[model samples]
Target chain A: MSTLRRNPLRALGGARQTPGFGDAGRVVPASGITSLLTGITSAVMAFLAVFALALSLSSGQLAQRWSATLSQSATLRISAPPSEIGAQTAAVLEILRTTPGITSTRVLDQDEQRALLEPWFGPDLPIESLALPRLIEIIESAGGFDAVGLRLRLASEAPGAVLDDHTRWRRPLVQAAASLRALAWFSVALIGVMMAAMITLAAGFSLAANAPVIRVLRLVGARDAFIARAFTRRFAIRALIGAALGTGLGMLAFAILPVAGESGFLTGLGFHGAGWLTPLAIPVLAALIAWAATRTAAMRVLRRES
Target chain B: MIRLANVAHDYGGRALLTGIDLHIAPGAFHFLTGPSGAGKSTLLKLCYGELRPVQGEIELFGQSLRGMSRDALADMRRRIGVIHQDCQFLDHLTLAENVALPFVATGRPVPQTDLRELLAWVGLAGQAESLPPTLSGGERQRAALARAVIMSPEVVLADEPTGNVDAEMSQRLLSLLVELNRMGTAVMIATHDLALIRNAKAQVSARVLRIQDRTLQSAGADL
Candidate 1:
């Protein structure tokens, strides 16, 4: 026993021997139903957790991308008469170029404007014939151009220029993405809680079914810790194996998903780079939860018997 | 050593044994005899810290049994071995493993040679690898006895240790208990077999206590 204690992993791996048993870990009879229930439950929970993790990470990436892309740029549209549109666009470009925080600016040509309106209208729409607004795209520096200051300057210089900073739509889009990320994470937490509950119930049933074992152990001068260790160790290993299988299947499913570039937001829901390593911790966490749940249940039942 | 002072126990909310006093000294040999449902097993349980007396102070190894923590009681129990009538065992474990349980429970390495010799002494060296379910009644009783003495406990409590065995096997088990007593381990056997008790007296000086009328009394020198 002292030799086994010196190398605890050996004990866990069933290397420790009893005189005639040849193995020290088979004190508790293996119950096929309990093992199956624990394994299936952990696998299912871990699989769902993987999806939730992917969704959360993807949503967060989407939110940050939207916020960064929209926050650094603004559009100035000169909606004057066709004759004055050129003059107003030129005036807005001059003001933006003179601005300290504005890095670069471009006026959307006829073809660009036509492409921008292609979704709304047909591809053959005559952009040069319509009395459309002239658009100026402004890219800001790291110290972004102040929206209020730029709007004032545009009003004085190009009265027909309406500076659309994209703030009105960007804020809501970022907020929606952030909320999605939060919801996904909450789902992951819910999965963990549900897994814990299921493992606890399983542990409880196992303890009930092995009441005779408990009685015999207690009668033989075995401490509660010894008995509880037997149970906790078994349940923890079961959960670990189950969660690993589930996580592997989930990752495989993710691998088969369409790439982010091919599809859209739904397809973008997966780990990127080092994020793939995140799900590996799920099995470990599941094992910890199982250990805790089984220990608590075992101690409770043993205490009642005492 | 176990000392019960004015111990009174109730079973199912009714008085079963009252004002029972017993002192199991080192190297002492005692036989507890009573009719069925006469509280002999209850007395043995109380002696081994399996049950708490409703009214009394029970002392084991000079420590009071009252208010003892479960772990402390378990530690105390390691010094006292008990053999139940049915010979409880982990059915999944082999006879040898069952015998070495005390060592395993205490986290001590099982003395392989000692375990083998002990089994051989109980005439079960050949059945070491057999599961408990495969053992006969006599084999189970002998296996239980081997388990009880595995730790070389200071006292041995046997609750009808020979209840299911033949006369030859019963004498065999009684002789084994006598041998353990000769080694200075206190022995208490709870049984209703007068012939076994008479047999035990010829081999060793033993005191006979009978539970009669819910009280313990020393038997007359009839045997």
Candidate 2:
């Protein structure tokens, strides 16, 4: 009844039709199991993704903190005969004071040393009785001291003084933290892949279940794009809702977690400040993944059937 | 309009319909009559682009069915409405929605007044909100008829449209098809009911083509 003159080739190739309210999503009947499966899979995957993101970011922060703290300071351990220990310590202290980048120096008192060793040696141990080496702590300025030059100076002035710049141990720790962060991000990627796979399977099942509905639609002159859009829109919405729930729960879990104080690594594994905004993108990403997965599945199935 | 030239279709590696030349022009009325499994449904499917012939070319609206893309075929189908013998409907949607499906499929706005009038004409005004499963056999057939012509298609191909309905309902459905043909919409109904054919011959000049031994033959006017 429409008087509009249309191109025959364009009509054959399928003209783009504006989607009406009826054409939007109600064409396919919503199945209970497939809907629930898609929602639950997206929610669970997004929840795990949030955890992985937190782990990756926290490990990155831990690596940076360790690198900064370890690079700024060095320790000098003076081990010699009890008669020469005091002279060697004095010599090392003099060399450290004249160093260009040395900001301050503090020698650990007996009580402080005892407290450091209390975890292993017990609080009741007599610190004076044992022939303990004298330890000198060196704090460096913003420009770090040259370890090689300082080591050469200490070896000449005080033979018993060994400069421990913390490189050998710090390097490995920082490397391990960096590796952990990479592994966490890899896990997030894996979770996204798994979500896509699950959504694809669910879409396939839904399409098969709605085979009769599809036949009816096709008989009524519904284009493949219209059918695919209906399915993709439904799946994307379900994923968005599910991911929103999962992300909210993840944020709440982090909120109630024990605050990171002087406590070690496990306690610091959470979002900090503006980093809290990162998880909000998860739902959007999940929706996109669902849309792509469902669209692919629908087109494949429709093409095969065609 | 549909034209089949030297079309031959096979089923399970055997010819079901062969050496067929048929044309359903604009405003033409056709009745395909044959025994069960005589390829009446198959021929209807071929006309609608549902099945391709193994030996000949079919043209719908002057465009060759061969080499047409699926989307192209789908778009071409919008000009030709088909009602299956089983009266397929989306079980979740109401009867009104099913009848207006062509509009929905093409993303066109449903003409509410026309939909209401069509339902009324089909004697289904009260059953607008009823589900397909709840409708009686006669009502389902009438609903299918309404759905088929709702798009104001150039042609309507129906397979055994009145197969499960009563004599009165069959007559009523036939009159609707006749009315549509009078309004310049080509119609083709595939059925085995000679009485319905006789009933239709009185009201409209129709061509009755019978499929016998894998070929089409024009029936005599003895009835």
**DockQ, each predicted model:** 0.31, 0.26
Model 2 stretches astray by more than 4 angstroms: A1-23, A73-169, B220-223
Q: Write the per-residue lDDT of candidate 1 for residues A15-38, one digit (tens) a residue.
A: 334443534467788999999999
Which CAPRI category fits model 1?
acceptable
TM-score of chain B of each: 0.98, 0.98
lDDT of 1 by residue, B1-223 (tens): 7999999999788999999999999899999998999999989989988899999999999999988999999888789999999999998787788998888876778898999899899998866766788889999999999999998899999999889989999989999999999989999999999999999999999999999999999994866
Worst 10 residues of 1 chain A by lDDT: A14-23
Best by TM-score: 1
TM-score of each: 0.84, 0.80
Chain A only, candidate 2, TM-score? 0.71
Residue A249 Cα positional deviation in candidate 2, in Å, after optimal superposition:
1.8
